[model samples]
Target chain A: MGAGLTLRLRNELSEIRRLTAALDAFAEDEAIPSDVAMRMALVLDELLTNTIEYGYPDEVPGEIGIEAKRDGDMLMISVTDDARPFDPRKAPRPDLEQSVEDRRVGGLGLHLINTMADVDYARINGRNLVTLRLLVTSDGDGDPVAVAT
Target chain B: MSDAGNQVQATIGSEWVDDVLVLKPSGRVDSNNAGSAEAMILGQVDGGAQRIVLDMAELDYVSSAGLRVLLVTAKRLRQTGGRMALCQLRPNVHEVLEVSGFLAILTVCDGREAAIGEVTKT
Candidate 1:
């Protein structure tokens, strides 16, 4: 398991703030680049926001867990939510060439994730599990340069 | 005593550069504060400031949630014949804007002066 950490959150949307701080600490302890940590926080925030907003329309409590494990140079991050059986990968990709007026407000979350990391989604035991693999660059022992590789 | 660690200190400073409104949002903008930030910017529009230049010099982090606010603001500006410019993006912020194709549609400049000039020009 590579000394992984799991963060469990309630269905409340405000809990995402705690999630960000936890992910940042995890990245720091794991020696991942700071910028990659920011990206991880962003994608995870997107997933949790969607689940909280759409997954529980009636404001009911639910389960959401995020697990991160360091596998060599790659960071394996997974988010499990007890939201509806919705697949984020199935969402339509926003056409980048579209004009400002033609562009839709949402749909950029998964698109941004797809550009930076490899993602795998599964519906297991009534939970949506989304795992992402991020290739990170390290700076030996000092501060890592904020560049994605 | 303070809700400091639990939340990113997202704040917007509003200034009027003649007809243009230069909004400086410091700290991080994500799902937590995007909606409120959007409303604050839109509030400026309601106050009759059409042109806007987002001074992102101090904005450390932005996500798709923040990007959505910019997109929404851009679309709203266009409907009213107003344009917006962004300047002084940190590398991380710039990369997010570039990867999401916002640089193509939004007027991004190297400095606040250039952004102000660009937004106020047309």
Candidate 2:
């Protein structure tokens, strides 16, 4: 397997399953901690879900790209899509303490993405690119079972 | 209730005992399917199921979308004098709830019996 992995999928909520599967396979190959893998699965799922659900105004299909590589103690992941420009960093934080009746269902995904990983956004050449960095450590299991693609 | 070869399959199971509705959702809950979950649970609640308990022992994963559904269900129940409880969450799901502060506000118990007990306490 290459030291880095890249994947592209159509912009649709159903495609998140494929993205998450690929991420888990990479994490297993790299022997990342289970908790770390779970977190990354979540962050990427949210990011891609957002791009698919809200990124396009015309309800047209678009392509979304994801790349991940292990960098020492950090696993850097990037997602690029042709969706409209929306910076998640500037999105308002969900007031988690609000009463259940007052809480809105739609805003928590962005909040989780911001809370779980270090994220950066850039709009370059008419595409929305999101970069997320997560701190990862091996589970210290000696027999690392690296799976092949 | 599953996602992929690597992710848990998403499934929602339910049981009715006495006057309470117990739902067991397994696998991943995200933007892809959260609306269905919300609709199903709230539909039951709107149909006049006053007491609900979510047995989460087999739940492998949950995102904010799932959390939103739970919170909305609970709030809806409260408005109609209904009650809801959650129990036996997997560590990751529990962690998400904790970080989001849902653990503090929602009724969480250790097991199905406890959750049912909590919901029926009144």
- Which structure among the candidates has the greatest DockQ? 1
TM agreement with the true structure for every prediction: 0.89, 0.88
DockQ of each: 0.46, 0.37
Q: What is the lDDT of residue A62 in candidate 1?
A: 87
lDDT by residue (tens digit), candidate 2, B1-90: 122223333478989988889998877777667777888888899898999999988777888778878888988887999999899887
* Docking quality tier of model 1: acceptable
Least accurate 10 contiguous residues by lDDT in model 2 chain A? A137-146
Q: What's the lDDT for residue B100 in model 2?
A: 82
lDDT of 1 at B41: 87
Query: Over the stretch B1-122, how does candidate 1's per-residue lDDT look in tens digits?
Result: 22223444359998888988999999889877887888888878777778899999889888888999999999888988887999989877887888899999899999999999998783
Off by over 4 Å in 1: A138-149, B1-9
Per-residue CA lDDT of candidate 2, range A1-149, in tens? 34888999987667887887898789888877877888888888878777776788655778999899988889899889899999988889888787777776667778888988999999999998899999886433313347899
